[model samples]
Target chain A: MSIRYPNGKKFEKKRIFSGQKNVNNKDDRFSNRGMSLEEDINETNDYYRAHQIAVIHKKPTPLQIVKVNYPKRSAAVVTEAYFKKPSTTDYNGVFQGKYIDFEAKETRNKTSFPLKNFHEHQIQHMKEVMQHNGIAFALLKFSLLDEVYLLEAHELMSFYDKQDTNRKSIPKKEIEERGHLIPFGYHPRIDYLKIIDKMIDRC
Target chain B: MSIRYPNGKKFEKKRIFSGQKNVNNKDDRFSNRGMSLEEDINETNDYYRAHQIAVIHKKPTPLQIVKVNYPKRSAAVVTEAYFKKPSTTDYNGVFQGKYIDFEAKETRNKTSFPLKNFHEHQIQHMKEVMQHNGIAFALLKFSLLDEVYLLEAHELMSFYDKQDTNRKSIPKKEIEERGHLIPFGYHPRIDYLKIIDKMIDRC
Candidate 1:
C-alpha cells in the first residue's frame, strides 16, 4: 500500500524511464520489459487470482486528505492531500485458507540488506501477525543481483532487534542461510507461494 | 474502502453534524454521538488489535491519480484524482488462524435490504474467498431499527443470483432466519468475532 523505497538511484532510473514513449523498435522496446519488484509481485498476484490459486491485493497508499473540490458536472478532485504512513504492511490477503501479510522491498546493495529499509512499526506489525497465527514475512529483493528471498518475520525481526548494536544490516550470507530463495518463473514471475508451501509442510 | 453509498440520507445527516462547534452540554454532546458503520467497525478493529484479539483493517479508498505536482522541498500534491471501485470487500483480516473477509453495509429500509448495496465483483470476491475455505460474510445493519446481522457469503450470493430476474432485495425476515445477529457492546461496539467463533465451532 505504501511505497517507502525512497529516492534511491534505481527508483530514480525507473522514474526517468516512465515518461519515455514512442520508442518503436520491437527488441529495444522488449528489452525494457521487466518492471520494479512491486509491479512484478502485483502481476504475480493477478496471475494467482486469474488461475483461482489465491486472492491477494496490495492495499492502496493511505492519504490524509486535507481538501477536496467537487467541480460541477464532474467527479470530486483531491485538491490537497498528504501521503500517510501505513499502519500495516503493503500487501495482505487470503491464500490457501490462511491470512498472509508481508512487506516487499528491494535494495541495490550487493552484500547486505539495510535495516533502514524497514520501519519499526512494520516489524511490530509483522510480529502481531505472527503472534496471531497469520503468515508473515518480508520479500527482500537484491535489485542488482536480480535475487529475491523470503525472510520469515521472526528472523527479520531478530536481525532488526540487533540493529541497536553496531550491526545495522543483514548480511547476504546470513540471509542466504535463513531465508528461502524464491525462484523466478515466467507465468507467476516470482513464485513465493512455493516457499510458503514448503514452510507449511515443515511446520 | 470505496464509499459508494450515493446520496444516502444518513450519510448526509452525519456530514451536516460534523462541524458543529459551540455545543457545551455534556449530555447534548454525548447524544449527538455514534458514527457511521465504517467508523464503528474501524474503532472495533482498533480495539481488537489493542486486546490482541484480531488484526483487521479497512482498506483505504482507492484513487486514480491523473496528475501530481511537486513544489520545491514539499511533498507531492495530487492535482487530479478520481475514486476507483474496489476489487475486494471493505474489510479482510486473520482471526483465530483463519482468513476472514466481509463487506459492511447499513440500510434504512426496515422490511428488506437491497441487493444493489453490493457490486457483482464484490459478490464474486466473496465467492472466491469461500472457495478457498476462507470465512466470508456480510455485516448488514438495519440503521433505523438499530439491528445488525452477519449473513454468510453463501446465503448472500444465493440472494444476489436471484436478482437477475426478480427478488432484487432480501427480506429482513429471511435475513433473520439465515444470518446470525451481532450484538453491540460498549468496548468493541460490534463484536463480529463472536459470530466467527460460532462459525468455526460449527465447521
Candidate 2:
C-alpha cells in the first residue's frame, strides 16, 4: 500500500486532478486526439509487451529529491524534489535479438519538425547507440496531421550537423523522403517495429 | 535552479541526511565497502558509459504516484505514491552488437544463494530475452565472501524450476563450478563485461 521514493521518502496518498471531469464514452478515450506522444507510445509498448512481440519501455522521468517527511502510521511525503535531465533516449528494449532505442516527440507545426526538441546529450546518446550497432531512431508524431514518422538517428544527426548554416528545422518533405511513415492501427498502435524489421532486412 | 516532480506541489529546498558525518579523505570514498551492490554497479556503469565501452543502465525504481500538492511559485511535490513491481529485469543494454540483460543481487549467505531473491517476472523476462537470442544472465554477489559470479539465465532457470522439490537455494559449490567468477578492480570495478565477452566468443 505504501511506496518509497528514490530519496527514501514515504509517498502518502492524496487526490489531485479532481478538476477534470470523467468521460463516460469508452470509445472517446481510445480516439482522444489530446493524447500526448508519450501516452501513445506507452499504449503501443503495452500492446507489444502483452503480445510477446517486443519489450520496449519508456525510462522513468529522473528526479532529484531533496526533502522527505516521515509521519507516524502514515506514508512518507516527498516535501521537495526536482526533475533531472536523462542521459539516454526515452525508450529502449530488445526485439529479435537486436537492441532498439528511440525518442518520441510530438510537434504542433504542420510544415517542419524543429530540431530544438532534442538536446546535445540526447544526440550524443543516439550516436553512441549507433556506434554500438543498436537500432536507434526517433518517433516524430505530427499532432495536427495525425501522422507518425520513424526517422533514423543517422539521418537526424546529418541534418543536426547542418543546422548552423541551414534551417533549424527538418522540412516535412525531407522527413517524408528519408523517414518511414509508421502505419498507425488499433492493436500495436504505431507498428514501428514492422518498419524496424524492414530496416534490419536492408542492413 | 528548480525542477518539477510528477505531482503538482511546490518542492521547496530542505536539508536531509544530516546525521552522516562528512569524510575528509576523498580517496576513501571510492574504496568504501559501505557502498551497496546497486551503487557499485551504478559506478561501474558510469565508467562504462564514459569510456563508450557499453551503455548499460540501472532502470529507476518504478513508482505509481497517485497524489500531488501544487503550491504557487514552487515545484510540485508527490504527496502519495505506491511502489509497483517492475515488469522486466533491472539492467539491460547493447554490448558488441548483442543485447544484454541481467539482474544484480547481493546476498549475505555464505554457502548458498536463496532462490527467493528473484521474482517470477524477472526470471520470465530473462527467459524471453534468451528466446530472442539475446544474452541474459544474473550477477550474484556473495557479500560475505566479497565475490561476484555471472550465472547464465538458462542455468539459473534450471535451478529455479527444481526449487519445488529440491532445496530452494543454489549451493555455492554448484555456483563456483558453473558460474564465471567476475574479476574486480579499481577503474571499472566489477568487470562482468569481461565474462560477457567470453560468452559472446563461444556463441
Candidate 3:
C-alpha cells in the first residue's frame, strides 16, 4: 500500500515493514519481532554507556516551563509549559574522547530522503559542531527497507547549501553511495558504534 | 529576613540591598546568577564537548508522559506527565575518555552540608557510577556564601553509609579540607574545569 505525508510526498508502506519482522519467526509485525529504530538505538546507547564504549544520549527538546503546581505530598506538576528553541543537534555525547553530535530521523520513502526533514537551525548547529571539530552526523532510517545509514555532517551540509537548486531530497542511491550503512543485529541492535569506529578511523 | 521551604528548611536572605537598583544594574539572586551551577557546568561541558574536553549534561528528571496534544500548527504539548524512577545521577557526561557523573545541590547551612539533601536513588546511582569506573561527584553550593565545592562520590558514599550513627551532615571544615574548591571566574563563571583538571590529575 502507498502512504503519503501531508506535504504530498509519496511513501511505500512496504518499505517500512520489510526486515522489521523477527528473523526467527514468520510474523514480522508481531510483538516478538522487534522494537522501533529509536528504541533499538536507545538500547544500543544504554549498552554503550554501561560498557563505557561510548557516551551518547538523545537530547530532550528544550521547554519553557511556565507554571508548576506543588501538591501537598506529591511531586511538582508542570501545569503550563512551552517549547523553546533548541540551540544544538538532537543528540550529542562523547565517543572515545571525541565529541559526537547528530540527529536521527526515520522515513518510509523508497526513493529518497527529503531535505525538508531537517530544519535550518539543525543545519546551523551541525555547522557549529563541525567548526568545533565535533563529529556530527545523521542516523537516517529507511523504515520500509528496515535499513539505517549514518550520513556525515559534512555531506549533509553540502546538500543543505546547494538544496535551493538541487533536488529537495537525497536519493536512496546517493545515500547508499555516500553514507555508512548500519547493520542490524541481536545485541546492540543498531550497532552504531561500529560506524562510529569507522568514522573515528577516518578522522 | 528568612524564607521557608515546604520541607521546612529555613533560608536566610543573605544579601542586603543598600539603595534602589538602577535600570541597568540588577541584583544577583540565587536563581539569576546566569544559570545554576548545573547550567554553568553543562556549558563548561559543552565547551569541553566542542573542544573534546568533556561530555556532560544535567539529566532530565525522568517523566512518564501520559498525554500529548498536537495542535493544528504547533509543536506537541505534553499535557499529562509524572516523574519516573531515575536510574542515574542528575548530570553525567564523558571527560578525557572517562565517564563523568554528578548530582548538584544547594544549601544554606553555613556550618555543615546536610546528608538529607541527596536522595537514596541518587546515592545508588553514584555507587553504580563508581562500579563502572566513572568519576562521580557532587557540586554543592552554599548559595549564601557563593561557595561551590566538588565533593567526590566516594566521600559522599562513605558519609551516606555512616548515616545511622554519624552526624547527619558533613561539616563545612571537612568539605573545605577534603573537597576541591571551585573558584568562580569569568567566561565560564563557575569555572569547574579547573577543579576537573585537579580531579583528573589526582586520578
Best by DockQ: 1
> Compared with the true structure, what per-residue lDDT tens digits does model 3 show for residues A96-197?
556677887766677888777787887877776676566778998876678889999898888778876668888899899999898888778888778878
Worst 10 residues of 2 chain B by lDDT: B12-21
- Using TM-score as the measure, the top candidate is 1
Worst 10 residues of 3 chain B by lDDT: B15-24
What TM-score does each prediction get for chain A alone? 0.84, 0.82, 0.80
Name the 10 consecutive residues with the lowest summed lDDT in model 1 chain A.
Answer: A21-30
Instruction: Residues B138-168, candidate 2: write the lDDT tens digits.
Output: 9987765778899999999989988875698
**What is the fnat score of candidate 1?**
0.70
> Could you give the DockQ of candidate 2?
0.31
TM-score comparison, 1 vs 3, better candidate = 1
Question: Considering lDDT, where higher is better, how would the candidates rank from best to worst?
Answer: 1, 2, 3
What are the per-residue Cα lDDT tens digits for candidate 3 across B1-203?
Answer: 89865563232232111111111112234443544555566666667656655555665445555555669998667666655555556675545545567887766567888787777877976776566566778888876677899899898888788877568888899899988888776656566667777767985
The residue-level lDDT of candidate 3 at A181 comes to: 90
TM-score of candidate 1 against the unseen true structure: 0.85
| Model 3 regions more than 4 Å off | A1-34, A49-52, A94-99, A130-134, A198-203, B1-62, B71-76, B89-102, B119-136, B152-168, B197-203
